[model samples]
Target chain A: MKNHVQWESSLFELIRRTSVDLPCDIEQGLRRACKTEKKSSRARWILEALLENVQKARDNDAPLCQDTGSLIFYFQVPVGFDTNALASATRLAVARATRLGYLRQNTIDSVSGSACATNVAYGAPTFYFEQCARGTVDVRLLMKGGGCENVGKQYSLPAESLGAGRDLEGVRRCVLDAVVSAQGNGCAPGILGVCIGGDRATGYECSKSQFLRKLDDKSPVKILARLEDRLLKESKVLEIGPMGLGGNTALLGLKIGSMSRVPASFFVTVSYMCWAFRRRGAVLTVRGGFKKWLY
Target chain B: MALLKPRRLEYPFTPEQVGSLRAGQFVLVSGLVYTARDRIHKYFFDGGKSPVDLKNAALYHCGPVVIRKDSDWVVRAAGPTTSIREEPYLPRIIKDHGVRVIIGKGSMGKVTEGACKAGGCVYLHAVGGAAQVLAEKVVSVKGLYFGEEFGLAEAMWVLELKDFPAIVAIDSKGHNLLRRVKSASLRMGRKLMKSSDPFIP
Candidate 1:
C-alpha cells in the first residue's frame, strides 16, 4: 500500500507534465487541419500562432494556454485495492504539481472570487472514482479550459416527437443545435462528447467520461456510432469552421455515449471541448515494485 | 481641398454603406460612440440610472485595457470582447439607445439580426485577441462610464478611436457574413463526411 501511494505521487508529476505540455498527437492534429484547410488564411494564422505558442510553452515550461483550467481526475480502480491513502497522496501531488507545472491558480472562491494560488481545494482533483473489474489503477487527468466549458448544454426532450424509441437522427439534431449555439465562442475547430438517455447529471457525466477515451477510438454503440457520423456531417454544414473564421472543419470529432431512458423522457447532453485539449493519463503499478506508464 | 466626410453619421446608416463593409475591413471612425458591456447593459436594463446620453450613439462591445494617472484614464489595450455573450441584451440595447454600430467578435443570434434590420444598424466584427495592436488606434480615452469595481475586464470604458479596423459582419439589409460562411463550410463538411473515403479510393 505504501509502494502504491508512492507510485500515485509519481503519476501526478507525469500528469502535470502532460497538462501544460503539448503532446505530439494534438500537435499533429492541428498541423493536419492546417494543411487541409489552406483556403482560410486567418484560420491558418491562428493555428500557426497556437502551434508556436505550444512550442514556446514547452520550451519555457509555461502553461500552453492562459486558462490553466480546473483539474479533473478520472480514476478507474481495482475493486479489491485499498483506496484509503489515495486521496491524501493525490492532494499532496496536486499542490506539488502546481509548483512544478507552473500552472496559474485559477480556482477562485465562488463567493469572494479570491483565487487559491495552490491548486488543491476542498473536493478538488474532482475525482470520479469507479471500482472496475480490471486489476490496476488507471488515472486520467484533464485540464478542461473555461472557454469550452462555458458551451456545455444539456436538455430533455419529449421521446415521442423525435422517434418512437431513441432515434439516432434526433440525437444528431440536438448535437448540431449545440454546436450552432456555440458559434465561434467555444473557439471552433472544437471536439464534442454527447450522451443520450439517462437523467441530466448522469448524462453529463457520461459525456465528460468520453473525453478520457483515446482520440483515435470510435463510439461503441451502433446508434451512437451512426449519430457520430451524422453529427460530423451536419456540424460542418454549420460553417463555424476553424476558429470561426469559416473553413472545412468546425468540429474535430463527435464521441457519443448512451443509456436507456424512460418512455416519458429523453435526455441529451453535449459537452464541448476546445482545440486546446490539455489532458493526460497514466497507470501506476506496485505489484513487485513501483512502475509508471504515461499515456 | 480634402473630401468632406459624411456629417449625419448617426444610427440607421444607409444600406449602401453597410454593404460596402466586409469582415476584416478597416475604417476610420470620426464620430460619437459610447462604450458598454454586461455591467452597463444590466445597469440600464436592470432599471438603474445612467450618467451619459446613449441616443444616436454607437455602443462599442468592448471592455478596454486601461491605466490611470492623476484622475485621467489612459487606454492601453481596447480590443473587442466576444459579442455573443451579450446576445440576450444587445437587441434591447440597440432599440433603447438607438445604437448604430456594434463592434465585437463572433456572430449575434436571430434577435440581433432582426434588430439590426429594423433599427438600421450594423454589427461589426473586430479581430479577436489583437488587444495591443487595436489599442494603438485609439487616439484618446474619452471617459469611463463605469468604475473599476466591475473588474477591469467587464467595466464600460468610453474610448475615442480613429481608424478602428473591423469587418461588417451583419449589415442593415439583414445579411450576415458569419452565418453565410458557416453554412457554406457546413455544406462542404457534410459532403466530405458522407463519402467512405473523402479522398480518392
Candidate 2:
C-alpha cells in the first residue's frame, strides 16, 4: 500500500537488470577461467565467445540468454512489511518485463500445456520471503536456464554402483558424477551447489540456495570448504571446459552445504549453474526505492 | 590441438556441404532455417505436418525470445537449447524431413549420431546461452507455425540468419568430437574416486 508505484518501478528495474546484466563476481570468475584456458583451444574460443556475448547483452540492454529461465525471487523484508502488496507489485513488474522483452514467454501451464506470455501464473515467478532483524528490504533475482536446470541431480546415499557411501566421499563422487553426466549438455564450466543431507525436496532447496553466495566467497564450514576446493580442482582434470568442449577448465567453483537429516536418510543434491549465471540483487528502502545493487 | 577458423556455409545447405566437414570444426552458418524444440518435434514425430518444408533444410533446436512491434516480429534472444532431449525424434525427423543440418547445444545420443551418418547430415553445436549474440545474426523472422497450441518455445519459427556461429559435433562420417570429451571425463571421474585422499568431511 505504501509507495506501490515506486515498488513496481524498482522491481521492474531489478527484473531487467537481472535479465541483462551479468553480475561482476560471476564475470570476474569467467575472466579468471578464460585466462587459465590455453589460447586457440576450442575451450578458449568458447569462453571468448561467452564473454563477448556477455558484453553485447549488457551494452544492448538485451536478455543475457533466450531461455530467460525460471524467474526466482528471494526477498528479505522488515517485519510487518506489506507482503501482499509487494507480491502484487512484483507480479506486475514481471508481466511488464515479459511484454518489454526482458523476459521470454517462459511460463507454461502444466495441465493445459499453454504458454502464459504474461509470465504470471499460480507460481511462475517463485518468491521467497523472510523477515530479517534489519529494517531494510532486499530482493534477489535468479534467471536460471532450463538446460542447466535439467541436469541438476539428486542422489541417495550408500549406493553400491557409484561406490558412494553416506559420507563426504559419497557426496564428492555424486558431484563429480553429476558433472561428468552433465558434460556439455548443461553447459559446462558450471558452478555447482551441493547439499549433503536432507529430505528429497529440502535437499534440492538447500543445494540451489547455495548459489546465492558469491562465486568468490568461501563457505564458513571448514570441512565443506575443503570439499569445495577439492571438487573445484578435480573438476579441472575432467577437461569439460566451456560448453563441454574439452578444455583446461571444468568448473568455476563448487559450494557445498550440509543439513541434519534423519538417521535413515541421506540425500545429495547438485544444482548445476551455467556460465550465464544470470543473478542480480537490489537493496531497497522501506519506502520501496532502490538504495543500491547487490551482487 | 589448435582450433580451426570457422568454415563458412551458406543457405541451401546440402549433403555435400556436410560431407566436407569433420567433427570439432567450427563454421559460420547462414540461410533460412526452421526453429523447433520439444513440443514441435513431438508433433512432427507423431504425424503432425505443417506448411514448413524440410527437404535438405536445417533444423535449429531453439526456443527464442521474440517480441512483436507493429507488423514486424523482432527476435531478442535466439540461442541453442540442449539437443539431447530431442534424441527420440531426431533420427526420424532427419530421415523424414530430409534435414541436412541440425543445430543445437551439446551433443546427441548414439541413435541421433547414426541417423546423421546415414542421412548425410551434420550436427552443429551452437554456443549455449549466447542468446543475444546469436539473435543478432537473425536478420528476419520468415514465418511462424503452431503459435497458439505449442506456445513460443515449442512453436516453429522460420528464421533467416547471417553468419550464425556453430561447431560441428557430428558429421556424415560418423565422427563425434563430444564422445572424446565424454570418455575422458568418465575416465577422470573413475580416477578421482579411486584416489588415495580421504573424504573432506
Global lDDT scores for all candidate models: 0.65, 0.88
Q: True interface contacts reproduced by each model, as a fraction?
A: 0.17, 0.87
Query: How well is each residue in B1-201 modelled by candidate 1, as lDDT tens digits?
Result: 011121223333444555455443334454455667666777767666666766556678776545556788765445565677777877777778666678777767677788888877778765553444455567777766556445544556666666665556787767777777766655554454344532110
Consecutive 10-residue window with the lowest summed lDDT within model 1 chain A: A158-167
Error of 1 at B78 (Å): 15
Q: How close is candidate 1 to the true structure, as a TM-score?
A: 0.66
Q: How many clashes would you count in candidate 2?
A: 0
For residues B44-153, write the lDDT of model 2, one tens digit per residue. Answer: 89988757779888999999988788999899889999989899998888888889999998857789889998999999999999987899999999999888788877
Q: Per-candidate TM vs. native?
A: 0.66, 0.98
What's the C-alpha lDDT at position A147 in model 2?
A: 92
* Per-residue lDDT of candidate 1, residues A1-295 (tens digit): 5665566557667555755576566677778777866543555655665566566556645455544567787777888665656766777777766655345455656787544646777756687778888867777778776667888988677434323234555565466668866767666677788888888788988888887766656777665566677667667556666657666567777788887777887888899877767778777663412256444
Q: How high is the lDDT of residue B65 in model 1?
A: 43
Evaluated on CA atoms against the true complex, candidate 2 attains a DockQ of: 0.77
Runs with alpha carbons beyond 4 Å of true place in candidate 1: A1-12, A80-84, A99-101, A133-135, A159-165, A287-294, B1-22, B25-83, B86-201
- What C-alpha lDDT, on a 0 to 100 scale, does residue B36 get in candidate 2? 89
